[model samples]
Target: MDTILNLGLNDQTVQVLAEATGNERFALDCYRRFIQMYGDIVLNVEFNKFEDALERNKRRFRVEYDHELQPEHLKKIIDEYKEIIKSSTGSEFPQEPMEQLRKAVMAVFESWNNPRAQVYRRVNKIPDDLGTGVNIQTMVFGNTGDNSGTGVAFTRDPATGENVIFGEYLINAQGEDVVAGIRTPLPISKLQEEMPEAYDQFQKTCTLLEKHYRDLQDIEFTIEQGKLYLLQTRSGKRTAAAAVKIAVDMVKESLISKEEAILRVDPDQLNQVLHKRLDTKVKFNVLAKGLPASPGAASGYVVFDANEAERCGQNGDKVILVRMETTPDDIHGLVMAQGVLTSRGGMTSHAAVVARGMGKPCVCGCEALNIDYKAKKMTVGDSEIKQGDLITMDGGTGQVILGKVPVISPEMSEELQLLLQWSDEIRRLGVFTNADAPADAKRAREFGA
Candidate 1:
């Protein structure tokens, strides 16, 4: 089985969209991607055949496949892809959207068995048969014009647990592009500068999701012709610090009871917060800045990017991973590094989320820093530091400082005591904080009533 993103277009759905856009191209394109996905997924059509055809089609169009391909170009590929699908499978791409949709759903269900997905489940201890729900949504265009864009935003900072909405957006781009790291995504702050009205409305939506869900919400949305359509929303995962902070703060805001707040912080994530991080006060010569997706302090010899970070680490050298922006490919670098830094993406970006999941130190979205990997040096406006010169990144403060500074792992806050007490009283569980170091447990107990 394969994971599938179903295009739930029916005759009416297709007709309406075709009528609305006055262009059948867009609907046809969606229809084609769905059929290709379904046939490969449900029918088990040989992927190499499609892959070979796609490569030839891309070459014929003289356009990049997937990466940085303009929406117009993608539309052209869609038409060509439709031809290729019919040629390979001897069937026209399914015109019946709902049948197209059902097959897609089954494909998604089957994706659970894909080797990659199975490995993921094994690592995470997820059962194999429990399937992913298919979200058959109305296609909301984010590539309509200048008034359109797509983004994924969190109700609060998952890295530091701050109340600020943290996210990335791609103006005039669509969903998967934002995640694929095809083109560097702009920070949400860019939306404020470029599209103020949309940004404001976006904030309101974030607030609504948080308020209604009563927890941090991660939302995916698109603006089409200056109107926002929410594609999906779910309770967000947060860093240990942010989890604690948001939980406590929510109690102060009267959003949830103290017990609920205590329950919100996962013990595993709490262990992550307890790790010693790079201190923020030291001076940094400066390197290229990317999106500050994750938070924590770290220092190591500069490895140009994820690949070097991994190679150096496997060879037993402490290395810091630097990149313009990290994608799914950077997982190895993140795994092998003492820390991570990026020049693009936001707090909700893939690098940030994955880094947090691994409990690795990461600082992203630092536009002020620049790294010249070829020279093995990082520079700010006036200062430059060599690759192996040693520098530090502060995840909590969003700073890249010079050398390793002394880290102070403080005891837990007094407020935590009250919060956890409430949780223990309510849930009737022991509610112990998972702490690697003694200081963490002391801090946990410090919050006792």
Candidate 2:
């Protein structure tokens, strides 16, 4: 399935896409690209056919990049793409802008039942009948030039909930280039060095968004020739530790009332804070290092296939699911696994996102681990670990160890104590625990039980 973006468009729909490059040229180019994309996605025309035509044109024009294609080249490609669509789908490409818009809108509605979407909805427990809605708005071009780019940012550190801007961006790239992990994007802070003016504007916008929403905001933005444009903003998803810290800090800052802050923390998330952690004092052989996609420590027999992971889990054997990259189809295995390890995917990829939501330990984008699915084995440097081999991982540190390692019980920090105290004060429901032993009761009491 194609990567879909839900953009909020106001009255100036055409103006936004055209603003960066000037006049109707950029807008017209966008429309042509849209027609090709829509034909392949909605009209069931093969994408390769359109891509081949584009590549052919690029070769003919002696252009090294798609963006280097001139207006005439783009027009020729669009015409060829349309012909391919007509031949393949037996339908004419909608030339009228309104007709194309209508079809695109309907295509979004139809995508709800696509295999990937269906799998995601089922795994996430989203109701199937709740059809997707279309939001037609102005398009913004992030791939106009070096000064133009797209990025995603968090008001606070997503991994630790630190009060800092955290995100990644790519110069002269679209939103999909970042989110799809097609390219390894530069750190958001790099924007400060590369485009200081745009970075300052973005910082101001982030501050505004957090203040207005009274929560850590995850924002998507585009810069057109050093001009900053906010695409969208929503409450950012953070780790359990960050969630607690953010809630308590927000209350102290008076951004939100105590009761609101108390309600912000999820009861289920508290379990995430209590998960096992590797003992830093104890040394162990580290197989590889990757991004700390989720927090916790887990040890299990390695399983390359998701279905095998599920089978092992159902049989009461702990398993860690390893993959090149995960999709919605791997959700069942992810649910059953003690942890997830992926070789190729960013922190926001499907594996990372799902593992975080499930409070499962995950290490992603581990480029050091070369996985061979057919052999059901993975090699990290000189060591080759086969299926069912015992392995341990520290998600907090993004360490993949050769064997089970020593771990310690996680202790509640001062921040957690303060947050829980505030929650206990304002929450209507009384907190209770079934700790039967003295030590268990003592720990519960310490956690504000």
TM-score of each: 0.67, 0.77
For residues 1-449, write the lDDT of model 2, one tens digit per residue.
Answer: 34333232212553575674574445545655666567666787876587668768889999865667776777677668767878887877654656656666777777778776776677657998877766665667777777889888889987677899988888876676566454456778899999999999899989988999999998888887788888889887777887888888898888998777767878778888777899889889899999888889999999999899989999999999999778665777888999999886667666776787778899988989899988999998889999999999988889999889888997887878887777666678877899989999998788777
For residue 110, give model 1's deviation from the true position in Å: 2.0
Kindly report which residue pairs in candidate 2 clash with one another.
9-137
Return the number of clashes found in candidate 1.
29
Off by over 4 Å in 1: 1-103, 119-125, 187-202, 280-284, 299-344, 365-393, 397-449
Q: For every candidate structure, what is the RMSD over all alpha carbons to the true structure, in angstroms? A: 6.7, 5.6
What is the per-residue lDDT of model 1 for residues 2-102, given as tens digits with 9 covering 90 to 100? 43443665445756766777756555544445555556666667555655565576687686633434446656656665666677678876767567667
